[model samples]
Structures are given as C-alpha cells and as structure tokens.
Target: MAAAATSTSTTQLSAPYRRSSTLQNSNYNKNNNSNKVPSNGVNGDRQVMVSKRGCNGVDNGGGFCWKASFMYWTLEDVAHVARHHWILCLFAVGLLFFMAVEYTLRMVPASSPPFDLGFVATRCLHRLLESWPELNTLLAALNTVFVGMQTTYIVWAWLIEGRPRATISALFMFTCRGILGYSTQLPLPQGFLGSGADFPVGNVSFFLFFSGHVAGSVIASLDMRRMQRWEMAWLFDVLNVFQAIRLLGTRGHYTIDLAVGFGAGYLFDSLAGKYEESKRRTSLLLHKEASLT
Candidate 1:
C-alpha cells in the first residue's frame, strides 16, 4: 500500500512539469515564426509589385518624379549653402544688378566712333602725343624693351630655372591668339601712334584683337609668383600696368584687347599645368605596369 501511495505522488508531481514544458515549447515556436520573413514565392511577388508601382509612379509623373528624388532642397540646405558660400551669394546679387543695368543701357549709334574710358582719361597724354610726335616713338621703344625683358624671362625659365610651364603657356596663348585674331579682325584705333622701333617693327601688319605683349608679360609674372620670386613678380605686374597705360595713351590697342590678353594668359597657364599633370600621370601608370610585369 505504501509503494502504491508513493507512485501516485510521483506521478502527480511530474504531471505539472510536463504541462509547463509543453507550454514553453509552444511559446518558443510562436516567437521563432514571428521573427522569420517568409522565403516563399509570395515575398518575391510582393517585392516585384512594389518595384512596378515605383516605376509606374515615375512614368506617370515624368520629370517631376526625377526632380522630387534628386532635388529635394529644404530650408536647412539653403541655410547651409548661405553659411558656406556667402561670397557666391554676394556675387549673385551683383550679377543681377549688372544684368539690370545692361538691359536698361542705351546702345551707341553704329556711325559713332569707338569710345573707351581709358582713352578719355588719358586726354593729357593725347595732347602730349600731339605736341611732340616723337614722344610716341620713344614710348614705343620703351615698350619694346619691356617685351624683350618678358621674352628673356620666359626663355630663362626653361633653360635656367628648369621649368618649361611658362614657355609652354606662351606657345599655347600665341597659337590661340593667332587663330582668333585672324578669324575676326578688328579695325585699328584712330589717332594711332606708329614707330619703327615698336614690336613687329617697320609697321608690319599684326593682329590687334589681343595684345601678345600683355599676355606674354602676364605669363612671365605668373611663373615668377609660382617660383616665389615676389620682387620679380611685382616688377612685372608694375611694368604690365605701365604697358597697358601706354597702349591706351597711344591707341595701340583697344581696352577690350588688353583685358582679353590678361584672361588668355591665365587660361593658357592653367592648360599647361593640366598638360604636365596628365603627362606625369601617364608616366607613373606606365612605370607601375612595367614593374608588375
């Protein structure tokens, strides 16, 4: 009878433990199923449906959809740009003002003579030129001397300084100038001063759209600055200004010609630098391949 009683007690205790174990297994299976995404064909079908919807949305909206995706500019973006590019914002305002001015400005009559502010400002120099015609010749001779200095410096940069960028830039600038100058020839300015000592001596026909003298000097000056030859750079800049004044005073070049010359010099120098960089990169890639082989 005691054996029977102990057996009944043991069975009763094990019954609750078995029930708890079964409940835990059921909970675990539910959690595992909830965590897992189904890998059946239905999931893939749903993904394809979503993708089709997106394509349809874009097709229906046309450019608007693309703009919405790419150009979602917000106030934060404007604030960020304003903080970083305040200078550009100021320039934008200036550009708008100038555009308005240009739109409102009156056009000069086709029969009217070409007018240049520099020419107007140098009225005294014009008077001097008229008073002593030989003064024009003297200034031309001085300008020739400055040209000689520019040539010497450019050549020296290649031969002595072992830097050929200035020479390369000059070559590019002159070639472009010749092409442009011949393509569109501008009429020579009136009240002109000619001299036998001037460049392209003996009054030879030359391109007047852009001044090689100014461009050459600018190229040399830029190279001087790159070399940290500050004094030489400053001297060249000063001489260039004087040369421009002389060109203006004597009507050797129109104001547009001188301005374009400065721009061309800077442009060609940048081109030369790019050319050197490309060459260096090519040589490096070749060396790397050769070593690997």
Candidate 2:
C-alpha cells in the first residue's frame, strides 16, 4: 500500500511538466506560421509587395512596359499612346491656332521688316524690363543652371544606358537658338521669322525659334520617359525652373509663346512618363513633385 501511494505521487508530479512542454510547443508553432506562409496565401505580406512592384507591366491591362522578356513596351505602344498624348496634343493644338492668328494680324512690309504690333510690344517689354543688370544677371545664372543640369543628365544617360538623347538634343538646340537669335539683332531683317531684335530671349522672330524649342523639348522629353524613375527625378526640376523663367520673364520670346512652350515642353516629359511605364522606380519619384513646387 505504501509503494502504491508513492507511485501515485510520482505520477502527479510528472503530469504538470508534460502540460508545460505541450504549451511551449504550441507557442513556437504560432510564431513559425507567420514566417512560413506562402506569398499567395490570403493573409501574407509578400503578395502585396509583389503586386505593387508589378506596376506598368505589359499585359497588365492598361499598364506599359519596354522589354520583351521583362514586359517592356513595344515601339507600337509608344507610338500609338504618344500620338494621342492628351495634354501635349491639346497644348500643341492651342499653340498652332494662336500662331496662326498672330500670323494673320502681323504686318510684313516688303520695304522694311516683318514685325507686327505684337512683336513691337513684346520687344518694348524686354527693353524696358530685362535690360536691367540685376534681372539680366539672374536670368543668365538661371540659364546656366538649366544648361549644366541638362549636360549632367545626358552624360549620365550615355554611361547608364538611359534615354536622354532627345533631352540633350533639346538643350543643344536651345543653346544654339539662343546664340543665333541674339547675333541677328540690331538691323533686324525683313522676314517676320528670320530677323528681329525685339524678341527678348531670341531676336530671330517669335514663331520659328519658340516653335522649334517647344517641338524639340517635347521630343527629348518623350525619349526621357524611357528612363528609370530616379533618372528623371534627378533632372526634371532644374530644367523646369529655367523653362518657366524663359516663358514668363520679359526677354527674348513672346509671353504667349513662352507660356505655351512651357506647357508643351512639360507635356513632352509627361509623354515619356507614359511611354516608359514598365521601368523600375525608386523613392526618387518625389523629385518630379518637389521640382515643380
């Protein structure tokens, strides 16, 4: 009887230890379950990350891409979408109409120059306001900043297999046009387009120089859209500031053209964004926003 009682006491002592071990194992299994869940499972976090990263993939319905195996956009996609780029098309159409109207109102006498009342007024504004040393210095500094940033982007593109040829082309032509327009001043020529000192930023008439810049800038921006987010973010802001100043300040261009061109050039950049939908992004996308503000 004493031996039986001893056996019962031993059993009671071991039972609590067995329960404790089972509880410990259950807690371990709960902790492990979260880590081991499949990404496709209902409550997993990895699936969300994958979906977010999948933006702009080809065959993702409306999404875009630029590669074959990697889901990059085809040339056709860029062409079609770019053709209908809503904002650019709208802005271009508006500028075309405005230029056409300006053309009708302008007076190009054969004996003298081709400038009209509009050119006269714009020129007067530049002479009166932009001739100041301080304003000139500020604008010149701004122009240099724009030019330098553009160069940096192009160099980066050359080294990194990025799309910036058009942007660089735009910058080159922009610089060239500036020089040519400035040199042709003083005894401005007869053709409405070829000669004029009145245009503040460029003396080479309003329609041609402004139109070319707007057009070239658009093309470059279109090409740049193919770059990764970080690439675009790096340079867009610096470019925008110069562009705005060119449009708004009272030198070189018609205020109208400058205003219109800003939208057009900006539209070019926007088109690139749509075209390169499949490129990888970085946190630097915020630069697009920050630059404008």
Candidate 3:
C-alpha cells in the first residue's frame, strides 16, 4: 500500500515539470519571432526590387539622370534651313526682275538645258494637241481648269459657302491648290517641247497653286492679325521654311521650280491681304506728293 502511494506522488511531480518545460519552449519561440521582425519594415520589398530598380547612373554619381531634350543643330544646318526656304521668295523677286528686264534683254536669246521633265511633259502635251482632231474641246477644258478666279469662285460657292464653311474651305482649297500646282510648266527654251507656245493659256501650271495651299495653311496656323507686329514678321520666315521642306522632297520640282512655286504662293497670299492696303497707301502718298509740289 505504501509503495503504491509513493508511485502516485512521483507521477504528480513529473507532470508539473513536463508542464514547465512546455512553457519555456513557448517563451523561447515567441522571443525568437520578436527578434526576427525587421525594424525598418522595408527589407523584404527592398531586397527583391530596390537593387534591380536602380536609377540610370553610376553608383558614385548619386543617380543624376538626364535626357536629350534638345534636337541636333549646327550653324551649317541653320544656314541650310534658312537658305532652303529663302530661295522660294527670292526666286519670285528674281522672276519679276527678269520679267521687268525683258525689254532691255529682248535681243539676248534666253538659253536653258535641252532635256528635262518639264520639257518632256510640255512636248508630250504639245504633240497630243497638234495630232488630236478634237483638240479645241480639250483646250477649253484645260483653260477652265487653269483659270484661277473661276476655281476660287467654285471653291467659294460649292466648297466654302455652306455649313461649317471654314472646314470645307480649308479642305477643298488645299486640295485644289495642290492638284493645280503640278499642272503648270514654265515657258523657257527648246528641245523636247520647242518654242511653240510660251505660258500657253490652254496649259495649266499646278505648282503655283500648290504654293497657295501650303502658304495658306501656314498663314492659318499663324494668324498674326491678332498677334504683335514683330510676331507677324516671323510668319514670312515660317512660310519660307515650309517651302524649303517642300523643295527638299525633290520628286516634284527642280530647284528653280520649287523656288518659283514657293515665291508664287507667298506673293499671292501676301497680295491677297495687302493689295488693298497698298493701293490706299499709294493713293495717299500720291495725293501728299501732289500737294507738296
């Protein structure tokens, strides 16, 4: 009986010690977990991404990054850009000068290269006219197409006069101008297309009209009427640049052709606006001069 009681006591004592060991294990686990928690809270995400997502620079440079915002430019490039468009306006002035001096240089025969696309086209057109039996009808048709005032009227009435007139006008005007621009050819020397006709009324020159559209579009973008006077001067230079870009394309026109085309467009546009003002000024000046005399 005594041995049985002793055994019971031993079992009770061992149960308490086992419980104490379990409690110590739990405390150890909690303490370890608390130590594992990062104070910064960013280590996990930083280790995975921060190293890879480095800013574009050497480590020593403190991530000083820059991008190329400026396009390439040079003095030669600037000069070329300037010259590229200036040729067009200058060409127009030169043409006018040449025309004015025609009487003085009447005796001197104008010379040009024998073969060119302009001449080729002119010759083809000439042959087609001379051989074709029903040529008069074609001539009349061509004339109607070439006539600027008639086209402008049609454009105004059918294209411009209706709903949202600005939209239609802008579209139709550009198209008409571009199309008519390639049709016209200069009346120069002989080779393929000999001197049968010079600036023939029946033939159309489209190059000129194209300038009108190009220059007109540019003018629309730079509506200087509301802007300052100095800003208005830039409009001319801007239009000239557009002309140069057109010429650089090089598929449609020769140097001279581009020059002339741009000049014509610019001049036509300028005159469209300033002609009345110019006349008024001229009249005023004439009256003032007369009074002074």
List TM-scores for all candidates, in order: 0.70, 0.34, 0.24
Mind sharing the TM-score for model 2?
A: 0.34
Best by lDDT: 1
Q: Residue by residue across 255-281, what tens digits does model 1's lDDT show?
A: 989999999999999999999999999
Error of 2 at 107 (Å): 3.2
Candidate 3: which pairs clash?
180-206, 181-206, 181-207, 182-206, 182-207, 183-205, 183-206, 184-204, 184-205, 184-206
Which runs of model 3 end up more than 4 angstroms from their true locations?
Answer: 1-100, 103-169, 182-209, 221-224, 227-236, 242-293
Ordered from best to worst TM-score, the candidate numbers read: 1, 2, 3
- The local distance difference test score of model 2 is 0.48
Overall lDDT per candidate, in order of appearance: 0.80, 0.48, 0.43
> What is candidate 3's TM-score against the reference?
0.24
229-264 per-residue lDDT for model 2 (tens digits) = 545643564465455444334434444444455565
**Better-scoring candidate (lDDT), 1 or 3:** 1
- Candidate 2: where is the Cα deviation over 4 Å? 1-106, 111-113, 116-128, 162-220, 228-293
